[model samples]
Target: MDMLSCDLDRTNEIPLYEQLYLYIKREIIEGRLHYQTKLPSKRKLADFLEISQNTVEAAYEQLTSEGYLEVLPRKGYFVMASEDLEYVGKLDVPIKTDNVKNESFRYHFHPSIIDTAGFPFQQWRKYAKNVMDERNSDLLLLGEPQGEFELRTEIADYLYHARGVKCSPEQIVLGAGIEILLQQLVLLWDAKTKYGVEDPGYHLIPRIMKTYGRDLYPLQVDNSGVKVSEIARAGIDVVYVTPSRHFPYGTILSVNRRNKLLNWAAEADGRYIIEDDYDSEYRYSGKSIPSLQSMDQKGKVIYMGSFSKSLMPSIRISYMVLPHQLMERFRSELSFNNSSVSRMDQHILAQFMRHGDFGKHLNRMRKIYRRKLEKITEMLKHYADKIQVIGENSGLHIVLVVQNGLDETLLVKKAETANIRVYPLSQYTFEKKYEGPPQIILGFAGIPEEDLDDAITSLMKSWGI
Candidate 1:
């Protein structure tokens, strides 16, 4: 009983029961209490803490309900075998608290967030139960290496109808996330392949290539996506791009450059293009441009997309559409690898797509994000004299190019002083510093719609614009 010490604050507004429960939970999480460790009886704890037995009983009941503690008939409450908690406690390095500090900001303009409030949890739960209810023997077995065939079919059908991508189910490869799929793609290619990435492209693409020890060149981007001419100049074999809507700048590849890039891939023996169509689903104004994979007549474009942005990041589901030329190689060489995603999750998502819940969710989110973007654009009107907005017509984030001549570092530091967080556009640039006007990327997807105006106003006030 002396092993567990809880200092109760009778003066604090929080209920004594809740404080005691939290204390025990923390002990369990931090590994101060080992698995199956006996806890003091309610009466014993009440006597030790100088509290009523009812308070101790209530705390134990809550902990028991949450699976942190278990009671065996006449025996005392014991901590469950929580492997997850033990692993977290054993980590040698400090857990990153960058995400934890997100709450400290009065206003957050984070770019890579989605509204989880609207997530179809109940509907997903229904499908999840259905998958288990059927108890199909097929589900019990390890799924195909590429992924469940039905899921690939559903993804293929959805891509064709939504993004104008034409592909057979056999062409799609599912992984836990795009990074895993990219690693597999890298393994499929020769080690000597020189990859070309857009100057201010998605940061992870180049980082992934570097992880595989491949040589990479950063091609500069203009009004129309990546510079296609630079591919020939740099003598690169592969180019990775976000052609549908470029990151930071949000420039869609013009028809001219799209054709030129395709030609470059076709002309060279080993040249290929990797089209990352992340966040292309949220185009607000004009019609969403068809994917570069849809436009490629030659078997050169390798299309990759993920549900993390559109659905939820925690789902860890992403897929890639391989060109027929590489599909053959992937089958013969790498088909033996096990799928990184859970088979149950794959089937549940397939059900979600087939039943049209996914499409409905996307439509609902598109509207919500569109309204958020509109509100952000309207509120930032107060700063129109000091800031020029770009890339507002599409995607989760909009670029605010400051006209006041403040450098990127000072602008971000100023925002932080006001408890506002703004992301620098230059951070996305690789190798070279962004030579354009000082800009910040404000992502509206994560921030609540009601908070958008307040966040923008905070930024304006912080900047003194």
Candidate 2:
């Protein structure tokens, strides 16, 4: 085997060795260099290229480190197997593409988005800068595999006081988002975990479970919350519920059903309940419901929460409280998994929680959103004869069932004519399809307060109400 064409740019800002490395790497990726092709010996290549042997050696070492080249005992460096290459070369063919831009809506009632206007950006920036100080220099490195101890401790303290969740720092595990934590929980399962989720659930829960190869059974959500009878009859080993405020529908799990669900978990082996206490901070009416984990004496409930809804979504911080049983499994099997969240972000959030900024932020958002909801409620009253409002007591969004004559399709189309966007509630259903009523979800948090009246007026005119 002979050496392929090799060149390096000396004038470029990139180092000579790095230039040589990129040149050789591209040759292999472009199929110019075949498998088992021997590279030029460092001494020989140095002499041919009029460069020092050390320079050639450095380039060869990098290629070997990256698995592009391998050395035989007595032979020189040879290109690795073609299949071992990390990237495959593609043809550079030009094709015609569409230049059309996506259409924008005037008013969008997206349920997932929160009110960003009230976000404590300046306060967060201060904490972020504070974490970068010399005293916290160790935070720059990989500090904790689970999460930063300070953040976990702060989360535990906040949950206990705010949501009545019982846990310590040792039981808390932080990750980038709830999706990541759900995947981790699935991986922690030891037995055949047949997971049961609400029919019109958060939607992501079932998808994540499916990705992890778990059998998902959709349980219908009745007047209270998830049907406990359906869960018991399904013979499910795991149950995921948003008891504090069910997503989209905003139904709180009644205490009667909570006990039955707990009893079901106690009777069965390898049974666990995942209580997603998401967005429990902003209840406008009545007392905030205690977390299902707070009621569990047998450690059956795994409490999950995130700052995405309460704070900003880009924070990428979510946490889970593992029961003693799952906590042991997480330690023994998945403890080595590095925390997905950054240590700096964790420290900043910890400081925010400790300084009571988080609590203050939630209080302010509650009042802001409550007032917004009040205006929205008053606006929707004009169409009360044509629509029935649901899930307005809590959460950022409300579900409106069209009562005049329009179905989900017609309602959305009519709303679109007014430059307003609305989401169908049926989209949240798994296999059940939620045929009770043709409902649409309208989020008031992200919309401007001043535009609320105009958006509603446009909808009324468009719908001929």
Candidate 3:
């Protein structure tokens, strides 16, 4: 009801605005400030606390940037409820604050979602401010067609060390998203470059392929990852795969399959593999698999990765590391094409990576996601007799095939009726529909750590488990 007033220590190293920002943030997070509560105006707070309006504005801006508060234009600042914990359950528990705001679902088990609750927005905001400063005016102009060289260099180095992807900065092409990069590839290559995709692959692949009118073949995926036999049988020229962690199923491509695929790529003149190591850093266990591009002796692998999955989706930073031939061809053919991503954002990201903030944030997120996975698996053991966890031993999402003879649609419906959303694995397929037992895909990343038990409990009860 009242404005935030904090005692500022002028002698302290931290700025006055930051002190006020922390105090207000604590009030909101600790539930001292009620949801939707409006704070005093910048001028009013400045006078009340005997601080400059600029200082008050800076504090509010920081809070707004970090998503702890919301600015409603002329309406002044209002609280965007950070009060959290998603649970449509039998048990009664007080809600805890999470990063999500303006929420809809009680529980959304979206496979593509990430842990936004723990994102390093503070660091990102700082970088963003520095990038936009007048000193970096060059970033305001059009950037290189492929992306900022500085950003690409950072990406190239990160990829080499983390995923064993061997590529120079010149080969890396940055785009707003994987879709845009895929569309670029479609436009660059000949129309007859038929593409083969893993069945139940990342949903974005088939859509991009068909949209561009490329001949699309649905390659089946089994325990060893995508079936190379199907690729050869289909006489496909290019293969798109997620070798590190397969989609929905989460199976890693076997070493034998990897070699066979490489051989297929090498055998033909135009054959190539597109490896989408989107969430490679989130691997929970086992030896790190070498990327397809790293293993390629020939210039036949086009490696693509995204910050959308590993980091916040809003970043919209995705990259492609092309073979030498394609890189040269791209430079010659698409020279006029400008960078899809904002140069300001690119430079900020480059700085973030160079300062090791990106790596540190990624490491912390991996640990958080890993813990969420463990908790979900452990909770599922309670329903072990009723559900079969069919997912691979790693990644953000898990697959559960119910013992009950219901179809995939019914499984999803049951969960939705109980205020929980569970995706059917069949929905992920492009051509070949899943005809197995009742199955659903649930991502642990979207669920808050404190809400897992109740969320799982409610979901199982909905299924009559």
Candidate 4:
């Protein structure tokens, strides 16, 4: 084993004994000193480091008291077993050898953090076994690109009963997830076509569309959702809107705007609409609104739905509901590209849905998530004067609008020092000249309800609010 090394600056303020204690403790926890491995004798370590024997003895004594090492009569000390440590490694070293030569990169929002601790692992295990136990030839073979017919059928039924979306099994085309569906849509649509995306919307759409050399117009949004009048005037061939709950802002598109937007798409001479109904399943208010796809009399909207936000992220399954007019073209394009979701996951999800367990699981999660949402709201309310908490009624995240002149960058840095994570809303915008109140997007769904109060208190102290 390589001997662990540390630099002890005599000029530094921290005591050498404490520094040595930390270093030795880290090594033992990292398994560098394996079970029953003898450490260097105190005199040898002190001589090598040019430090006194008493300091080395103090470090060893502290480590032994902390259960990182065991001392035997006259045999000196040995490292403990790996099972005794809570975490199995030392802190990761910085990537670069020289800190001054670091390069800067654009900031990106953190990925959605889900609390896996609360996942229904036992129930999922049962369902997984049941699926394999009842497996047949189709389950083992390459299934349909539109996904197993059984899953499509189950999804159609679930959407109808739960979200009031009118659809048949044939209309639903399953893919790996939202990104995959977006890729397929870009492939089906010609590269030269102009696509309209909401300003300050999900940042991924612009990046994805740009990769295919498609022209994009950043349509503006307000309290009612994406502005239909502006989108109509933009003269774009394709419009992508999240009507259920606007991303980041979390505003539902009003019924009037939804109808007007659909009418405009119909008048635009066969223009297409991509509706991303991503987290609409967890609304905590009045009845869930019917999707724009349900109101498409002229076959203008292509509905994309995903189970990533509803179920677990590992279940990379999402489906698109296509209009009958574009169904053949979509199928032809998808077949040429060979894009499809996993056959096994599709079968398992189908079985879960058919047995009515999927619905039951959703109901149970809704209750749990509702409680979490309330806790977050209560905490935000406690800081009402200093922070404006928006998007409280729906979705997994809430936006806190901070007062002007506050440096969000510094606040975020301070929070990181306390081990609390948050994201700035401006990171999602594409336009550089756009300005607004400083805001942070905090996700409560992934955090424990019991920790909500402490997390909020820590954030407040960090901000000095």
Candidate 5:
């Protein structure tokens, strides 16, 4: 057939039969040739392509054996594997290749990156299949305005048990991510509200607030996290705090400051605190830290959590627990906005939690990350004199307070020269400059346990530490 357009490269090392087989296989898998389409006869194809008849016959035989085609009596080979072809097509996803112009590193310490090798893909696939069954047709339609009650119920239960966060499923709102939820919150709150954000904190929160023209005060951070007294001085209406383990620096908020921050929000009617409990799941030493939401006596804290770090980031499932007042306000004002997350994903995650897979996965990842952190500390013991480690008590990353005549910029550049990428703590700041000691952040979660030696060793060589 004219559609079987293939140029035979006789000079190529691959035999003509194998090449023809691969070409026909790709065409069938990619839907260029549909199910039940008849192929040219072996002799006819050989003549058209100026190849031997045996070559065409061998190709057709291979395709038939692989279930890509079927032959009927007196009829030619026809495409027979539609369902199998779909599965094969899905596996042929396009992989992105790196740009030759850009620099690629052997070791990268990206703080937000997580190891997906531990993901329960088999279990997730099972739940996904269950959710996609024809019986669950309701998932195809629009779900509840605030995510599916099933998923919210699971999230509420998990938070109550794991993080001591007290909230009903009704108070939880689900979205595609923290960014989407933050955007919705900016729309709900007053435009004039001055938000207080940590100076050396997760930069995205302040950036998101600024995008909506919300006034922001950069609250300087110390070893004990953000101070509540700073909020009073700035006249901030709201503040975003990471109480469990501060982002980048990993400073845990002191109990007294937590109480004072709660009091600060309670003192004013409109004042509230948004606790972003990002990456608190893996505490290497002691028990997992309880959330700031657990200490709120007044309805002033909006507790937000994401699966981006604890689970797979690509899932894009994030939820926020609203106080009764804000929950009521969201219902009355923001009810028109539908849930940003997919109903199918919600149902699947609910099933995953229902089967206790999520809890098990968290426990497994904790042990895995704990081993990696321990390996890192063990390997870096030799360089202890040159570098001081901080924020390794919890979370996936640790900050190395380094010296030996190297500034933050020089440290990063030196690591780059050694084919390793390390982050500087100053990158987290925007308005106010980071006045702390020169610190380089190394995220250990994505790094494998076996390579911890080489990675840390290479990094040390890079910095001459």
Candidate 6:
């Protein structure tokens, strides 16, 4: 317990008290300090270190606040057995060192069509001011774990009219994002729930399902969307699908496939379907497809929607329309966990929807995206002989199917060397072998129309077209 013997270096940039705090925390994490070990009196340590008693006291206070130590009346301080010191210490460290060396640090791409500089900050500020001016004390506190009532109701109304989704505000369970809601669904249906994920799908869905220890059935999808017959034949307990606009491929699920899938879910008693309606609002081609939930006569589909793609990713507000029978169960389980969307953002979003600004914003973005898509299409036409650009009829990204057995990995690396970001279709496929031609999934939504020509030129050169 002699502090001087421990070599306390005061010359270091860190303060004396903070240094002491970190030293003790590291000792606990390294297992050098065992549980229930009594420490020498603070006064004694202060005397040994030639430091003030207050400094030792301050360090102890910080340790106690962080749950590293506990104080018993007349018994002094003891190391806390409840604290996860080792896990906490290792949290900030990198998870995988090998991957860090091979891959670029930048993975998430910013769409070209999205004008971040043009966000309606002034209008948003006005709305925020109005909310604060008419503050409700109840609203200031956590209103509901599901969501603020007004936002859910507004969303219900919006979906019913716009997307043809049938549901009441009560059916809408709001959360931070689709990932959180998906995890909740997996936990809800924990017993032998086999999730049928689209092969070559959004990579996150399969990863998340596996993280939760759920069995996944990789369902193959083609130009017509997920093979509904195969899913039914496999007898999956739960099916996760993107019907509006399929991820990475941009193929809309055919109405025939959609109907069959619904019928299959209905036939399999106690089975459910999750329809991820992501990026459907910004369709550049024909009318926006009706949601899978809208076609459900059996009420078995759980529709998942997010504001991230349409609005901003950081907004983190997503919702699901649950079946009537499962509503009570969802509420009962979620009531204990501190998982709820922010009330302030919810209020702002609800007001945006109520005032019809949400619709206006969508219209504005759609026009911008359409114009950008046109310019990109014109540029790609020059290299049509080497690459076929598909899926430009809708969505923010287009698929460039390589012809003549081109090496897609080399194209990706060459594009990276030229400071252009492009994703290979192979990255999304779960199976080792795929029947489709090699393609590159190039996103145009995150780039500017002015830069489209130059970017496309660089990409074409990289492909040696």
Off by over 4 Å in 3: 1-103
Return the clash pairs for model 4, or none. none
lDDT of each: 0.84, 0.83, 0.82, 0.76, 0.84, 0.77
| Reference-based TM-score of each model | 0.79, 0.77, 0.77, 0.77, 0.77, 0.76
| TM-score of candidate 3 versus the correct structure, residues matched by position | 0.77
Q: For residues 118-181, write the lDDT of model 5, one tens digit per residue.
A: 9999999999999999999988899899999999999999999999999999999999999899
**Judged by TM-score, which candidate is best?**
1
- Clash totals in order: 0, 0, 0, 0, 0, 8
Candidate 1 segments exceeding 4 Å error: 1-104, 137-140
lDDT (tens digit, per residue) of candidate 1 on 1-465: 344689976533355687788888888877788899999888888888877778888889988887889899999899987773334333233233223132335666777777878898999999998888556667777888899998999999999998999999999999998889989988988999999988887777777877888998999999988889989998899898999999878899999999999999999778899999968998988788999999888889999999987889888989999988899999999989999998889989999999999999999999998998899898888777888888989899999899787888878878877867778876687885667678888887878888777778788777777
Question: Which residue runs of candidate 4 sit more than 4 Å off their true CA positions?
Answer: 1-111, 133-138
Give the candidates in order of lDDT, highest first.
5, 1, 2, 3, 6, 4
Residue 370 CA displacement from its true place in model 4, Å: 1.2
RMSD of each: 8.3, 14.3, 13.5, 9.9, 11.6, 11.8
Angstrom error at residue 223, model 6: 1.6
Ten residues in sequence with the least summed lDDT for candidate 5: 94-103
> 380-413, model 2: which lDDT tens digit per residue?
9978888788888888999888776777878877
Tens-digit per-residue lDDT, 89-125, candidate 3: 2322324332223223578887778888898889989
Q: What tens digits encode model 6's per-residue C-alpha lDDT throughout 49-87?
A: 766677788878888888888889999888876455444
Question: lDDT at 33 for candidate 1?
Answer: 85
- Please report the TM-score between candidate 5 and the true structure: 0.77
Which window of ten consecutive residues has the lowest lDDT sum in model 4?
A: 98-107
Clashes of 3: 0
